[model samples]
Structure formats: structure tokens, C-alpha cells
Target: MSARRTSRVLALWCPDWPAVAAAAAADLAPTRPVVVLHANRVVACSQLARSAGVRRGLRRREAQARCPDLYVARDDPDRDARLFEPVATAVDATVPGVEVLRPGLLVLAARGAARFFGSEEQAAEQLVDAVAATGVECRIGIADEMSTAVLAARRAALVAPGTGAQFLASLPVSELAVEPSLAGPERVDLVDLLHRLGLRRIGDFAALTPAEVASRFGVDAIAAHRCARAEPERAPAARPPAPDLTVEYPCDPPIDRIDAAAFAGRLLAVRLHDRLADAAVACTRLAVTAETAAGERLSRIWRCAEPLTPEGTADRVRWQLDGWLTQRALRGHHPDHDEWTGIATIGGQAERPGASRTRRTAPPNGSADNTVAPGRAVPAAPIVLLRLEPVEVVTAGALQLGLWGGEGEQEERFRRALVRVQGLLGGEAVLKGVLSGGRGPAERITLIALGDELSPAADPALPWPGRLPIPAPAVVLVDRPEVILESAAGAPVWITDRGLFTADPAHLRWGTKDWQVAAWSGPWPLDERWWSDGHADAVRAQILLRDDVMVLLLFGRDHIWHAEGLYD
Candidate 1:
């Protein structure tokens, strides 16, 4: 069989879009140093912050230390999408049929745009000017493949037709992770593995036979291999979707609130997935279209690396609706206007179309807010109809279920529930704990919001000389209570300069309670960050009391003993 060819694509990337959106939300000056953080690690930084030695993956404290006046913001996907709606709108106005890869990146077919403008360069210039009109900077790149186009956009380069492989050859293997929306952040591991195997460049990785990559690296590596070879994102198996596959929902009273839209979106997503499954196919590209009561139409296309699951489909639909409604609200349109606020109940119970309702009611337990800003109204025009159409479809395969009854299915359901809860509350409402390198139990774990990257603050595999051994304490204290460790003579116990205990710990007094120490382990010295001004010198020891209670204690340089953790 012959190698598949890639299509000509043009990509546009907005640099540090999260930082830009955050700055705009906070009304910060453009010259102010800013960074967007997730999981206490920098994910994006403004040019001003980069100049001050701030970079992605740096810890919050380190970033703050590098730039004293740095303004830090949390990574908010909803905010990013809401703020990016204008930019996408501008690009759509300049060149129609723009596909949003994510909040900060978009792509379109270059062939049509280039021909209309007489040259690819001219088309790119127009796109840049369109985005600049919105007060945001962007870079454009044209290439024969989506991933290559995205990388090229980072450098503002244009690759000639049929030269995509050559264009990708010299780049480092790490570029595989450049487009997280395409390759996903999981590519970080793949890139690291490739680096360790001496495949330092894309050309080197591409040189290996497909069979070799498949046998050695498994199924996930196949997509990366194809990308290295500059082939299409997927096998050229996509075909026009069947007409009956299109799912449409007509709102009788016209839904205006975001919570109602989200509810409608969930039902629509489920119907679409069921239809696809019945047709023995899966959706790779989805087009969401909405029609307002005033006959206004809004549409967007979302491309996914893998076939979209039900939860994924719902997420994309909700995000697109949010962007549209929020953008309208920000433009001073109110849901209370006569054009909107005609809905009665979203759950199949409808009132008259032109009837107006003004009272604001709270959504169900897990529905999102309606307004973009706290006090702003919903969209001016209520949605009269919503449609989900599959632009590209691929044959579905048998799902491998776990031996013990649907473990994977249960996990997926739980994850969807968490995402729903997160939408109802905020991003930080649900948190996941990740392990990292640190001497103290509390320091060893990092709590990051769910759905964010699981990157740890420090490397867990690195050597930590004074880290606690196996069988860690069951309970970690959030507030360290000051305790008094004394010898048999009732004198305060201390640590010597040589990292040794001055006296045997015989008595423990915490608050008004006292207990006799039955046994104790040796004090382990931990002198952390000695090079920095905020260095900490502390020693820890595990102690057993007469009441059969075991606790971990830390003696700091300030001559205070605190109960750090408790054992079950």
C-alpha cells in the first residue's frame, strides 16, 4: 500500500492565551508580569514574566521569587474559551470555516483561503490582522499536516507543499508534546521514552519501520509514529456521516440560561452517541450548530485525537455554548430583554414561546452558572434549536471489558460525575492528590484540582536523603500543634549540632494532656534549602506513647516540638 498524503492546513496560535485572558479579566496592565498556574506549577507565562526568568513547570514559590511583583492566576478553561470567542469570531469573519483545536489554537483549510487571497502569505497576513484587531497577538503557519502546522505556527513558518516530512525532520522529539490538544499531555512520557532510546530527533523516530514501533511501543505510539512520518492524523478512513446520524433538539420555549443549555446538551450528546453506536461507528469530528429565535446561527467544529466518548462530546458542546452565551452577555446583551427569557421548564414541559419570565432560579445540583460575570445577564437571544452533526465517522471496534464486570465503564461513569460536579461548583472544588519529593509527609503530597494536569511540584523518583520510609503515617496533620518533649527529669529535650538527640524523649505534653513515652526512634536530620534565605533546619522522630498512640514529631531550629502526623 502507498503512504497516505497529508492535507494542506493553516494553523493560528495565540501565545500565552491563558495569561492574556487572565490579565484581561483582572484588568491588569500589559507590562505586568503574569503567570497562569495549575497544580502550583506554571503552565503559561506572559512575555514580561518570561523576561524575569519565569518559565513553564516552575513551582509557584520559585516563579514568585524570580519575579517579585508577578501576578499569578489560576488556569480556567471556561474563562479562556469565553475570552477567546472574539478572536475566533474575528478569524471566522476573515476566513470562514475555522476549526477550533482548543482555546488558543485554530486551523482551517489553506487551499481555499490561499487561492482566494492569491497567496498563502497574504491569507496568513489577513488572519493575523483580524486577530490583532481584537487586541491579541497571534502567529500563523501553513503546512501539509495539522500537527506540523501547529508547530510551524509557533515559529511563524510556512512549509511548501509535500515538504511536511522535511519540515519536521530537524525538530527535537519534544515537539510531539507541543500541541497538547492533538497529542494530549500523555505525549510527555512518549517523548521522554523516545529520548532515552536515542531517538533524539523526529527524523530518527520516523526512520523506524511501523512494525518496529508497534511491537516495541504499543498502540499509542502508532499515532506519534504517523505524526513523525508526516501522515494524516488518522488513517484516511473518515467518510461523510449518514444523514440520519444528525441529532437535533428544538426548544419549544427557547432556552436562554446556561444551566438549561447544559441540560439540553447532555441529552443531545447521549442521543448522538447512541445513534453512532447503533450505526456501528464513532465520531472523530463534531460540528455543533445553534439557532436563535431571531434566526441567528452559530457553529463550530471540534477535532479530537481519539473518537469522542459520550462525556467528551458533552464537554465540547457545553464549552461551545458557554463561549457563545458568555460572549453575548459580555457585549451587554441581557437575558431579561424581550428577545430572551421565554423558557418555562427545560425538561419537556413547555410554556408559550413569547411568554416572559424574570425571576432567576438556581439550577439543579450539578448545573453551571448562567452569567459570564457575577452580575451579568445571560445571552440576549435564547436558543430555539440545537443540532449535533458528525462531520467525520470511523468504524467502531469491540470494547475490551475487564474480566470482573465493567471496571472501565464504572471508572468512566465516576469521572463524568466528577466533571459534572466541577462544572456545578468551580474548577478547584474537587481535588486530586499527587505524590512528590519532600521530607515531610504534608510536603510530599500535592493537591491539584481535578481535570488539571497531574504534574507534581517535585520529582518523586529523585533521591531524598531524609524522607520517611515505607508504611507512611495514616493521618497527616494540617495544623501542627506545638508539643513538649521532655527527659525523665522534666527538662526540655533538644537536638545537638551533630544531628543527635541531647536526651531520651520520656514525656510528651500537648496542650493540657501529658503522656509517658514508651519507645522512640532516632531523630532524622533534614536541612532543606540551605542555600536559600528561607532554608529550614528540622529533625523528625517517630514516638510511641504509654496510651498506645504513635505520633511523628518534628523539632525545628526555633526550639519547638510539633506533632507533624499521627499513626493509626
Candidate 2:
């Protein structure tokens, strides 16, 4: 087994940084009460505002009512991230290998700095002094693991060696929910479930074995349990050299959906992977870039533990595109916007749009505010170009021999045959079903090239509410055939506004034939993508016929019914 790459961690935290940054930008006194809001709710508040019961997550009116003089500013994540860069640079000058968790939070390899400063306590004091020079209040904590270090930083305590788990033991179970690193609906629900199960503390949840946690709660919970037990994740390995070849795809009219980009991404990934395979190398770091029609470019670099598979590469491309598109759409910043897509303009340095254009909402601090107004449509920027460049590559290793080597050989043979076919026909012609996790039956399956690896097309760990229960359809039809549900009196059945059935479904009709219903269930309604302007909101229901055929039906806002899928 490989040796563990564990190291002591030091965390630096700046409290209510959004409020602080906003207040500072406004040239307000440090004693003034300020609160930063998002979605009309208070997300960050100054100490003075907090003292007046203007807490985080409170509505704006409630917060203002509590502190009548509280200065309210809209939440701008770009502003927070930009302003925090200097603090990060300052910390890096004092201690190397700093990892920023978010704008207000960061952790560093503490052992070297502690040794340099003669002790961890002295190191923390020096770090605090360094940040204080920037006029921001900072706290420090040192512990054996990142999560424990973050918690300790919150309380401004240094946990002793081999005692991080013990230090975390007394913290409330809800700490897992509030962890900025693990913020998501899934983590929140898991913590809530633990509370309902009488596990009210981190120690209580950590007492269970990893196997038990994995079996019952899934992979995400196991990750949290590891953190609670003070286990440090494996450190990242050193990077390798970049590949010589870079693949690019240009869209003519541009595309809207991420799935459309993913299709092109898969083809490019295979081409890149094949070249690396010929050179007997594997990619470790992939750089994905997408350019909008209006010349704005978006790029991100992803580093993985192992070599990149075709599906893995495609997945990263899809994820990065999703993040960029969602950010632009939600903030009402199209590629054609005069300013940058996500960055805040400083000191009149931002480029201005043409004379014949719309004036954006510019905040007093000389930054553009991209918050979408209520009922305003999110602009759909077309993706015109995609480029996949390998940032790091390593030597491919020999496969480990096992007793099931014959099966491995068979799989290799199949892969070779598919590749040969792909060389003849286009990549899209050689298709295979890849499972994608989602609430809707049609959305759960994705089609990719035949020889590509089967990575998760979507996050299965997500708490997909209203997803169909198990005994999943055996034969999900690829071509969704249109069908109609009829009542006992031969009239079409319709769903009511309250989601109730207008009449009992007694028959199902295809083009010319009608099938009698033996036994049936559902009309379990599902709503999806209501907020996005690109896709219309859809509602769907699943029904089981007496003939034992299971089918999924969809209802649009226009009340038209269509067959979504057929179960095996």
C-alpha cells in the first residue's frame, strides 16, 4: 500500500467578508452596521448588525426591522472573490501551499511555518498579524485535518496532535450541514436525517463504521464521516508534462444545451485519448475551453487522481459548461454584454459596449451587478467553440493480472472492434446507453460512443426528489411513442390543477389499437426546469398497465400529453 500523505493544516478565516468588503468599498466606518443580501435574504451581516439580531438567512425586511439603520447591499460573489485575492496573496507570502476553500476561508500546510515560527501558536499569531495589516479581522486554527482545522479556526483554537477527532466530538451534528465545503441540499438532508435518527453530535455519527455508513447513507455520507473522524484525504500528486496535440470544435450557429456540447466533447475526448494511447501515455490534467459567439471565452482546468478516460473528460467538459452558462444566465450577463461575464470591473478598466446598446445595472462601487430581476428572462448565449487541451500526461502502466483475465481480454477485443467501426462510420453512429442520474425517466439515460468509459453522466448522490422508486423499467423505449389515456366512458382523461386525476384511466390508445387497463397506479406529478428560459417547464407521470407494461407520460404547460418512456 502507498504511504499516507497526511500533514498538519492551518486555517485562516475572515468573518462576514461580504459585508466587510461592501462596507470597505463604500468607505464606511468599521463600526457601521452593514448586511449583504442574495435572493432578498441576508447572507452576511456585520458584527454590529448581528448584535441587533440581523442574522444570516433572515429576510431583508426582518433584518432591517431588527436593525433599522442596517445598510443593505446586494450579494456579489465576484466582488467577494476578487477582494479576497489580496488576502490570499498575503497569506501565501507568509506560508506556501495555501488552498483557498472560498473567498473568506483558506487552509495551508502548517508544519513548515510552525517550525519556522518556533511553534504553532506563534505561527498563528504571525499569520493573524499579517492579515490584520490589510484591515481585516482574522482568526487562525491548526489541526491534523482540513475540516477539523476549519472548525477550530471558527473557535480560534489549536487542536493538539492526534486529538482532532476528539476536538470534533463535542461539536453539534448540524456542523456538517453548515460546512461551507459540503454545502448542498444532499448534505443538509443527511444531517437532518441523522438528527431525526438521534445522532445529535459529530462524534455520534462518527462512531459508526465506514462500511455501515457507505451501505446505509451512500458515498457522500461516508466522506462526511471520514471528515468527522479527522481523516485526511490523500494529498494531490505532482503534475506531469502537457500533451502536444490540442483538439478544437467550432459550432456554426452555436448551441444552447450542455448536452449538445457534451456530444461534441465526447468526440474530441476520444480523438485526444487515442493520440495519447498511441504514445503510451495517459492524461492527468485536462483544460477545457468554450468560447461564446460574442468572443467571450470561458476556460477551466481539472486535475484528476488517475488518468483521464473518454467519459471522464466529457463529463468535465459538460460540468464546466453548465457552471459557466448557469452563471451567465442567472446573472443576466450574456456574452454580448459590454463588461466581462463574471468579473467585477474596477477603476473604469472595463470595456464599454457600443453606443447603440443597453446600460447594465452598475453598483456604486464601480462594479457591474448581474443579479436577475424578478420576471426578467435569462439570456441564452450560444457556445460557438470548444477546445480540449491536455495540461498533464503520465506514462501508462501495465494492467494487473487477475483470475478473471479472460473477461478483461474479451472486453479489450470488444473495444478494439468498436474503435474500428468508429473509424469507418462517424463516432455518433457507434452509440451506447450510459446511465445518467436524474428525477425524470427520460433524463436518467444518456447515449455516448460505444468504446468510451462509463463514468457518471450526472451526480447520482444528488437528492433527486420525485424520482421513481426502484425496480426500474427493464426496457426503456428510446423512441418515445405518442399515446392517449381514456376514461371508462371513452373520453380522454385530464389532470386537474391540484394534480388529481379527472377520471379513472380505463384504456390506453396508440395509433390504432386500444389496450384495456387491468391494474394501474400513479399520476405522480414531476416539475422540472421552471426557472430556465431555454427549456419550458415539464410535468410527468408514471403508470403501470394491467398487461404489466410500465410507461412514463409527460404533460407540458399547454396540457398536451406525450409518452416519455416505456418500461421493460
Top candidate, metric TM-score: 1
What C-alpha lDDT does candidate 2 achieve relative to the native structure?
0.68
Using alpha carbons, what is the TM-score of model 1?
A: 0.64
Return the lDDT, model 1, position 484.
92
TM-score of each: 0.64, 0.53
lDDT of 1 at 156: 98
Q: Candidate 2: which pairs clash?
A: 475-568
- What is candidate 2's lDDT per residue for 1-568, written digit by digit as tens? 0222237788899988889878866777767899999999998999999888888889999998999988999987646654564455345445544555666887777777777778889989978866765567888988887778888998999998888889989999888767555344578888989999999999999999998998899666877899889886544333454546678888876867756766777778778776766676767667676777655555445555346666667766665555455434434553354432222111112223431222234321231111222112222367888888776676665222224332133456677888898999978878887778887666688888775787768977788988877766666655666778888999887778787778887887878977777655566666667577765444556666765755545443445567766666
Query: Candidate 1 at 31: error in angstroms?
Result: 0.5
Write down the RMSD of all candidates, one decimal each: 14.4, 17.0
> Looking at candidate 1, what is the lDDT of residue 457?
95
